[model samples]
Target: MNLSFKKPSVDTCSKCDRINMKLKYAFVDQATNLKTLKEHQEAFKAAYEEKKANKQLAQSSEVVAVITFDLQQCLPTTYLQTNVAFYKRQLWTFNLTIHDLKTNKAFCYMWPECEGNRGANDIASCLYDFIINQLPNLHPNAKKLIMFSDSCFGQNKNSIVTTMLMLVTRLSPQLQFIEHKFLVPGHTHMEADTDHALIERIYTCQEIGTN
Candidate 1:
């Protein structure tokens, strides 16, 4: 007589499910926002430190080399009514490394031809060869290698970038003996002061002369 029927557990309705989904999404969004904020903070700190170091290096009288490469695309004057064919044109890469006289450290690689049509591996190899063979012979006391390149194909290529990084890491023991450091992708003005701006000026002159 005192026994009562057990009530069935209510299933979650569609509206409740939708509300739960929205709550889950809100949490995910919040987490993503936090992660982004942390990343931005880290990047800012790193950038600030790099700017300070570069400014000090620039003021120093040590040897600094700016290296850069440039590529030019020349299209033929064929006015075909159908489709236009763009030739490979020409790929020109330049490496200019400057030395800070007082410190005797070379710090700069300027590659203007890294953008459009050129391969990243080519640029990376050029930088590697220049540092390992060319610069050392030029300045025995040269210890630092600073490279400035556009956010172009060369910098974005994983194979090229990885290879360059691997080479650097492998050479860390030798580099450490001379206090060598590599810099890539900082402020534009820093790069502009290096071979990036100079290369553009030279390339423009070359183009004008060719035409």
Candidate 2:
């Protein structure tokens, strides 16, 4: 990965001389809070380097994909009887986000109206369906799979998920290797978070308009 910073260069041509740059603003202090600022910069740099490396590696015939899955808690519109007079029903949404390292494309699958309890079996079932049914259509040439998920015991990072991946490798002729990894317990911020945020934002907008 290229670690050298590339300063913005000026374009010469009149028709295509426009410069495109993106600036991100966040509150950071380097005076007394140098540690925090440095940590943030290191994290950002690490992510950038990894992405660059993935892009370079994706050009090969080996297909590279990073997948993240999680369940989102959502409040339902209807109500039901409970210990209290009435309570709004709650639902769980299983969101699977796949980021193709080669093409830098993101795909999201949301399964709504899910039951409250989510175990390894449920997670494995959803992943299996995607792998066997949907993934081939999306990336027919992909042979190796890499998956990332939170360290939650019941939802992911368990024997069930490992078994599922192994089964895929064994059953699918196109798949050669499968690897599943658990993100740090508190540091799992990936594409799935962005997917969840978008869903939440859309739901919030709908609620406001309805009101």
Candidate 3:
């Protein structure tokens, strides 16, 4: 054996050297492509300014009232048993509307049943009738009508609910049904103070056994 050991041959490792060079170039390119702090700051400032302007505009405009409806099954309780004996549960739909003082606009509609005797479609029709007939009569000078309701099978189904909605629209052209701009999800509490109180009081008074 030779006393001196030869160093690993660089000639045989040319491919590895090339790969390392390529990786170095790639890293440098990636670093150069990254956004600078000044650029990021400018973008963030622009976005913040835009949002602030939008907030100011929204604040300036008048906020309108929103109407909503909820359906509940009036079960034949001990008190109501005498009057409502035949049915195990009586389905009652509540229509509520709230008027915004600032905008002078009104929104009204009926709530869809989550799980009960009343299907989503039935509640939707009730709401449509109230909107087309009742709303205009209630607020003659209202600039716009905003109706809100829950998403339930009867409300969102295509077969019957869509047809009913279309028919309603045709029947009453004055009451335009804006589909996409309905009530905010999970925000009925905001309008409940105005609409829900009166409706509940009336229903309570009109209970089967109540005088």
Q: Highest TM-score: give the candidate number.
A: 2
Give the higher-TM-score candidate: 2 or 3.
2
Model 1 lDDT tens row, 120-187: 66556655676676655654544454443334544433566556756774774334322223323332
Q: Rank the candidates by lDDT, best first.
A: 2, 1, 3
Give stretches of model 1 more than 4 Å off: 1-49, 55-117, 142-159, 168-173, 177-187, 192-211
| Per-model C-alpha RMSD | 19.1, 12.4, 22.2
Query: TM-scores for all candidates?
Result: 0.41, 0.62, 0.40
Tens-place lDDT digits, model 3, residues 85-160: 5655544443445443333444545443334346556655665666567655654544344443444445543457
Model 3 root mean square deviation, Cα atoms: 22.2
Best-first order by TM-score:
2, 1, 3
Residues 50-130, model 2: lDDT tens digits: 645544655565565545566655434422235552443455455556555555556665666554246788778878987
Off by over 4 Å in 2: 1-56, 59-62, 78-116
